[model samples]
Target: MDFVLQIINGLHVGSIYALIALGYTMVYGIVKLINFAHGDVIMIGSYVVLLSLTELHVPFWIAIIVAVVFCALLGMLIERFAYKPLRNASRITPLITAIGVSLLLQNIAMKVFSANPKPFPNVISGEPFQFGGVQVGQVTIYTILISVVLMVLLELFVLKTKMGKAMRAVSEDAGAATLMGININTTIAITFAIGSGLAAVGGALYSTAYPIVDPYIGSMLGLKAFIAAVLGGIGKIQGAMLGAFIIGITECLTKGYVSSQLSEAVVFAILILVLLVKPAGILGQNIREKV
Candidate 1:
């Protein structure tokens, strides 16, 4: 029963990771840029929710909506003004820009929200559910359910929608997509919007579970999610989800049975092993390039 409970806890955490990883995977698939600043978007989302709930006095759901919209617009703007200008530049240029953007966001957040960590509001209050001698928090249940639902919806959207087809086309060949009247810029912008919106949702769920928000929180969270994306196969959505669950479970079990301080090290070590064994990731396919 204890083991089962730990697995559940891990799943809850993994769900949030999966949400953030989706954003990373989607952006990388289309733009082939790591978007290191992606994690800061999660931090921005948390602040949006925090201010909305505390200052604006809005309902929890409304706060989430506001966060999603704000982050979506922010993502689009980042792509439009920052990334788009450097789209055709050398790859390393955009990579450095991404890191700079991340630092900029962190500093901006520090100035706006201060360096102190604020307590996240307990929007959902309830006792833990006991099942077969295992306890599960209400927040955990909500986090897992909502994350899974959103992922499924996103998968359906990407597989079945016209815009999704355009996204895939752009990913495959931007020049060809433009020649086909696909509006490459708009497609990439929409992709950023969706990915950012998912990050906002993930941010809200993360705050609920952790009950704290800080300016630097997104950096570590984003790093883990990026690792999850790489582990699951960067361009594959389902692979990202699978990798998140694996990472979440491993982290939880390690913390529970091993040293808490060693859990992160263990996770990174596993990533290294995986990379050494299969650089393309679990579900990633390696394509040979002609020299």
Candidate 2:
């Protein structure tokens, strides 16, 4: 029963990672850029929610919506100003710029919100559900349900919608997509918007689970989610989800049974093992380049 509870806790944390990983995978799939600043966007989202709930005195759901919209616009702006100009540049150039953008966000957030950690208000209130001698927090249940629903909606959008089809086309071949009349810039902006909006949701859920918000929270969370993306095969949407669960569960179990300090080491070690054994990732397919 104790072990089962740990698994539930893992799912709670894993869902947040999956949400963030989806953004990473989607952007990488279309742009082939890591967008290291993606994590800082999560931090921005959390702050949005924080200020909205505390200062604006809005309802929890409304705060989430505002955060999502703010982050989405912020994402589009970042893509427009920071990434668009360097779209055709060497890959390393954009990579470095992404890191710079991340640092810039961190510093800006520090200046604006200060370096202190703020307690997150409880948005969801409910008693833990006990089943078969195991108790699960309402927040955990809500997180899992919300994550699953969003993923399903995303899958439907990507597979069925016209813009999604355009996105698919762009991801396959931007040149061909442009020739076919697909507005490459708009599609990319939309992608950033969706990814960043998802990051906002992720930020809200993460703060709900951890109950603390800080300027630097996104850095480590984003790194772990990136690891999850890589573990599940970057650029593969479903793969990112799968990788997040595996990572979440592994970290939880390690922390539960092994040394808490060693959990991070174990997660990284798994990444190394996966890269050595299956560089393409569990659900990733290796595409051979034609010389």
Candidate 3:
């Protein structure tokens, strides 16, 4: 029963990781740039939610919506200003810029929200659901359900929509996509928008679970989610989800059976082993890129 409970907890945490990992994977798939700053965007979104609820005195749902929209637009702006200008520059250039943006955001957040951790409002208030010997909290159930639904919706949107096809084309070959009448810029921006919006939702769920808001909260979570992405295959959506679950489960089981302090170490060890054993990841392909 304890093991089962841990699994449930793992699912909840993994769901949030999956959301953030999807953002990482999608943007990487489209732009071929690992936006290291992606996690900081979650920090920004969490602040947006915190301010919306406390300062604006809005409802929880409204706060989440505002965060999502704000993060989505922020994603676009970052892409346009920080990334777009260096589109043709050396790859290392944009990578450095992403790091700079990340640091800038973190410093701004610290200055504004202060380095102190703020107590997050638990908008979810309900008893745990009993399932025989096991139990699940309302937040856990909501997190898993919302994560699954959003992932499904995202998959459908990518596979079925016209813009989705354009994204796929752009991911395949930007110049070819442009010649085929697809606006590469728009497709990439849309990809960032979708990914960042999902990250915002993940941030909201994560803060609710931990019930604390700190300038650095998103840092470790984002790093873990990034590891999940690399473990599952960096550019594959399905792989990101699978890797996130594996990571989440491993972390929880390690914390339960082993030491909580070693859980993160175990997760990183898994990443190292995966990289050594299969650089392409479990679901990843090793196709060479076209120059």
Candidate 4:
């Protein structure tokens, strides 16, 4: 029963990780650029929700929508102001710029929201439900259900919409996509928007679980989500979810059975082993270098 409980806990955490990982994977898929500022974006989302709830006295559902929309718009702004301008520059230049943006945003958030952690209102009842000898929380079920729904909607959008087709075209070959009349700039911005929106949901859900918000919170979770993305396959959406569950389960089991201090190390070691065995990752396709 304890083992089952641990697995349930892992799934709950994994669902949040997967939501954040989706953001990383989507951006990487379209642009081949890891937006380091994404972490700060999640941080911003948390603050947005907190402000909405506490300051504006908004309902939880409305606050969630507002937070996600705000993050999506912020993502669009970042792509327009920061990334788009540096498109023609060296790869390292953009990467460094991303890192700079990340630090800048975090510091700004610290100044605006303060360095201290603030508690979030309990959106979901914390009562646990028992199923097959496993105790699960309503919040956990909500997170998983929402994650699955969003993933499905994303898949449908990508596979069915004209804008999504243009995105795919640009992702496949930007130069060709531009020549074929696909709006590369628009597609890139939209990709960032979707990715950031997903990250907002993740931030909100995570805050519900921990009920605290701080500037540096995103740093650790962002790194872990990125690891999960890479572990499953950086460019694969489904792989990100799978990797998240694997990592979460491993960490939970380790902490429950082994030493808490060594849980992260053990999980990362396993990540390294998986990468060494299959560098492309479990669900990744073979990426050929451009000549």
Candidate 5:
């Protein structure tokens, strides 16, 4: 029963990781750039919801919507101002810029919200659902359901929508896609918008689960999501989801049966193993290029 409960707890955390990983994968696929600042979007989203709910007295759902919109716009802005200008420059330039942007946002957040950790409001409150000896919290169930629905929607959007087709084209070959009359810049911006918005959703869910907001909170969460993305396959959406569950379940099981202090070490160890065995990840394919 304890083991089963741990699995459930892992699923809850995994869902949040999946949400964040989706953003990472989508942005990478379209732009081929790892947005290090992507994680901080989660922090920004949490604060938006916090301020909305606490200051404006808005409902939790409304705050989530507000945060999603705000983050989406922020994502687009970041891409336009920070990334777009360096589109043709060396990859390292954008990479450094991304790190710089991350630091800039963290400092800005620290200046505004301060460096203290704040308690996030418990949006879902109720007794745990009991099934035989196992009990599941309302928050856990809600997180799982919402994350699944969002994942399904994103999959459908990418596979069935025109913009999604353009995104795929951009991912495969940007020059060819541009010759085919696709607006490369627009497609990339939209990808960032979607990814960042998903990060907001993850942030909102994470705040409910962990119930704390700190300036540096997104740093570790972002690393976890990045690892999940790499573990499942960085460029593959399905791979991201699968990796997230594996990571979440493993971390939870470690914490339950082993030391909580060692859980993170275990997670990092798994990543190292995966990299050694499958550099392209579980679902990733390796392509050979001739110079």
Candidate 6:
């Protein structure tokens, strides 16, 4: 029973990682940049929600909505102001700029929001919902459900919507997309906005479940999410979530039976081995370069 519960806990954590990973993967797919600031962006999201809830005394759901929107808009602005001008610069330039932006946001947040961790108000009331012999918290169930729903919505958007089609076109070949009359800049910004919105959802759920918010919170979680993205195959939408579940469950099982300290080491070791065996990842496809 404990083992099952552990897996559920892990699944919830993995779902958040997957959500954050989507932003990393999406931005990487279109721009070929890591967007190191993404994790900090999530940090900002949580702070926004926390402020809205505490200072303004907004309801939980409304606060979340406002936070997500704010983060998405901030993402668009970041792309426009920080990245757009340097789009044509060398790859290193943008990458460094992203790292700089990450540090900048973290420091600004620290100064503005303070370095102390704030507890998020728990809006849900109840015990774990039981199924057969296993027990899971309503929070866990809600996290998983919301993650799955958001992922499905994003998948539908990417594969079916007109904007999604344009995003896909840009990912395939920006030069060709430009020649085809696609608005490359708009598509890129839209991708960032979508990715950031998902991150905000993940951020809100994370703070709600764990009930702690801090400026530096996104660092470790973001790294884990990035790992999940690589593990499942970057640039593949379904792969991100798949990787998240795998990592989440594995971490839970390890922590349950094995030493908690070594669990992260073990998980990362598996990641290295997986990459060594399959560079493209589980669901990743290789693109051949023309000679």
RMSD to truth, every model: 1.1, 0.9, 1.2, 1.3, 1.0, 1.1
- Whole-model lDDT values for every prediction: 0.94, 0.95, 0.92, 0.89, 0.93, 0.89
lDDT per residue (tens digit) for residues 146-265 in model 3: 999999999999999999999889998899999989989999999999999999999998888888898888789889999999999998999999999999999999999999999999
Residue range 1-291, candidate 2, lDDT tens digits:
879988988888899999999999999999999999999999999999999999999998899999999999999999999999999999999999999999999999999999999999988888998887788889999999999999999999999999999999999899999999999999999999999999999999898888889899999999999999999999999999999999999999999999899999999999999988999888888898979
Weakest 10 consecutive residues, lDDT, candidate 6? 116-125
- What clash count goes with each model? 0, 0, 0, 0, 0, 0
TM-scores for every candidate against the unseen true structure: 0.97, 0.98, 0.97, 0.96, 0.98, 0.97
Tens digits of per-residue lDDT for model 6, 1-291 = 787789888889999999999999899889988888999889888888888988999898888899899999999999998999999999999899889888999999989878888888886669888899887789899989999899999999999999999999999999999999999999999999988988888889889888889889889888889889889889888888888888988888888898888878977987898899988777888778989
Candidate 6 matches the true fold with a TM-score of 0.97
lDDT of 5 by residue, 1-291 (tens): 898899999999999999999999888877778899999999999999988988998998899999999999999999999999999999899999999989988999999999999998878998999999788999999999999999999999999999989999999999999999999999999999999999999999999888989899889999899999999999899999999999999999999999999999999899899989999998999888958
lDDT of 4 by residue, 1-291 (tens): 899888878888888898899888888888888888988889999999999999999898899899999999999998899888989887788789889889998999999989999998888976787787677888888888888888899888988999989988887889999999998988999999999999898899889888999998899899888889999999888899889889888889999999899989987998999899999777888778989
The residue pairs found clashing in candidate 5 are none
Q: Write the per-residue lDDT of candidate 1 for residues 1-291, one digit (tens) a residue.
A: 778888998999899999999999999999999999999999999999999999999999999999999999999999988899999999999999999999999999999899999999999898988877778899999999999999999999998999999999998888899999998888999999999999999999999888899999899999999999999999889989998999999999998888899989988998999989989888888878859
Candidate 4 TM-score over all chains jointly: 0.96
Candidate 1, residue 10: Cα displacement in angstroms equals 0.9
The Cα error of candidate 1 at residue 26, in Å, is 0.5
Of the candidates numbered 2 and 4, which has the greater lDDT value? 2
lDDT of 5 at 74: 97
Stretches > 4 Å off in candidate 5 = none
